[model samples]
Target: MANPAVMVLGATGRIGRLLQLCPPQGLHLRLQARRAQAGNSTGDWHIFDPRAEPAALARAAEGAAVLLCLAGPVPGRGGADADMADHVRLGEAAVRAGASAGARVLLASSAAVYGARGGLLAEDAALRPASAYGAAKAQMEARAAALGAELGVPVCSLRIGNIAGLDAALGGWRPGFTLDRFAGGRTPRRSYIGARTLAEVLAALLAAPVLPPVLNLAQPGAVEMGALLQAAGRPFAVRAAPAAAIPEVALDAARLQALLPAPLAAADPVQMAAEWALLEPEMAER
Candidate 1:
């Protein structure tokens, strides 16, 4: 099949940039930025300020088949109320516009959205979002699913676990940081996927002609903090800080692997970790 025109709502985010670096198989990446985020640009562009109107979304998403949302500074994410509002508004608008455009929506979710889990987490795991950011993501997933079902559109919710790579560099996870502390050697146990790996997964999902209501996008194995840090070639503590509340997340890689060109990405914490650290920096930094 020919590539699809995909409009990424959070085109400027860490994940979005990675997607830009090596876009999925069928994506004509169109960026959706707020008026403020949109200063100077050339090429196909769509201006969207979730705070303003959902109508603007349709214009931005015109002729697009897939809608990928990576927008807004979510609540409890080191931002002001206005920032939080942007997140909520963005979700609603994207849902509405996605349905209107008859587009498949990919809602980027986090395992953190599942709240505190005693063991490995799955797609059906109960969501007890401990933080406001998790709550927002949970809401977004629910709304996306509901809206898709109610309409003819299909939505894919990737309940991701801790993500390594550049998102870590951007401090996307803090206060309740996942990969860092894990990589730091603190919070000894953690599970995560590298940024490029995540981009590849999202690409596969977007490529699927049909999407299930929800899916889990994470590695098959969960590694310890010490190993993660060592893999990344960073220095960290063996155990997490006293206040840290870590959840053991389980990601079913079978589906993710099925879409891959070959074998699944590395599952060993040390090796996979090293791939991102030793190999990534030396080879694939861009």
Candidate 2:
């Protein structure tokens, strides 16, 4: 039998690029992008915006076991309202595409949805978004969940935590970068998942026969920002945390742990730093 096919929408973003380097084994990968990349001539890549081109999304989703929607407006490119609206449109398209085969639609959400909530948040926690981006994602989750129920399709919105290679602490590290030191003399901490580990989690979810409507995707514990920087051998300055700074955004991943076959990656800062460094050269070429 052929391997299950998994189509990744927005296959050229930060997480997507890392997945391209270390794709999951035993899954046939199909890619969707809004534009073409430099060295990709693979026939599996389809170029079109899912929000605008339903037919293209449908075509790309055919025969696929999962439609992973990673398409969204990154920070600074589009307004927060636009991000929420676009996700609703894309979610609708993905659900409709999978209506025939009942393919699982996994929508990429963010930890930003949790906002300034500073404790370990679970999948069922009440959303208390603190920023425009967080508000938009919270709204997006509600809309997408309702649409999935209406269409009778299995949809999961992954409230993803910070990805190691894509996060500000490691990926955004540069000389003279400033970090916030809280009154307790600690830096900001957040639940983080390595890019490669994320890919494996997605693959495992795709193969599973059952899934929840919502899930939190991250490692078991939160790692300190200062620790990540120190592990990467980067020097940085710290400033007193403003009153508005969130001390932590740790996620409760017990629900996720039950689903996976093995333990997730350690939340150790050095290990997370290595995960980020593994893709630097390839990321630079792209």
Best by TM-score: 2
**Error in Å for residue 199 of model 2:** 1.9
lDDT of 2: 0.82
Model 2 CA lDDT for position 259 = 94
Which window of ten consecutive residues has the lowest lDDT sum in model 2?
76-85
Q: Cα deviation in Å at residue 91, candidate 2?
A: 2.0
Scored by Cα lDDT, where does model 1 land?
Answer: 0.65
Tens digits of per-residue lDDT, candidate 1, 87-178, equal 55666677778887888787777766777666666677778988777787788787767766777677777777666654342223234333
Model 2, span 1-286: residue lDDT tens: 9989988887887767776787777888788888887866854788988888888888888899888888777775565445556666776777788775568888888888888886789998988889766777777778777878888888888999988768888878888988999877789999998767887888788788778988999999998898888988989899999899898999999999999999785687888788778777888786
Clashes per model (N, Cα, C within 3 A): 7, 0
Q: Residue pairs in steric clash, candidate 2?
A: none
Looking at model 1, the pairs that clash are 10-70, 121-250, 184-236, 185-237, 186-239, 187-240, 188-225
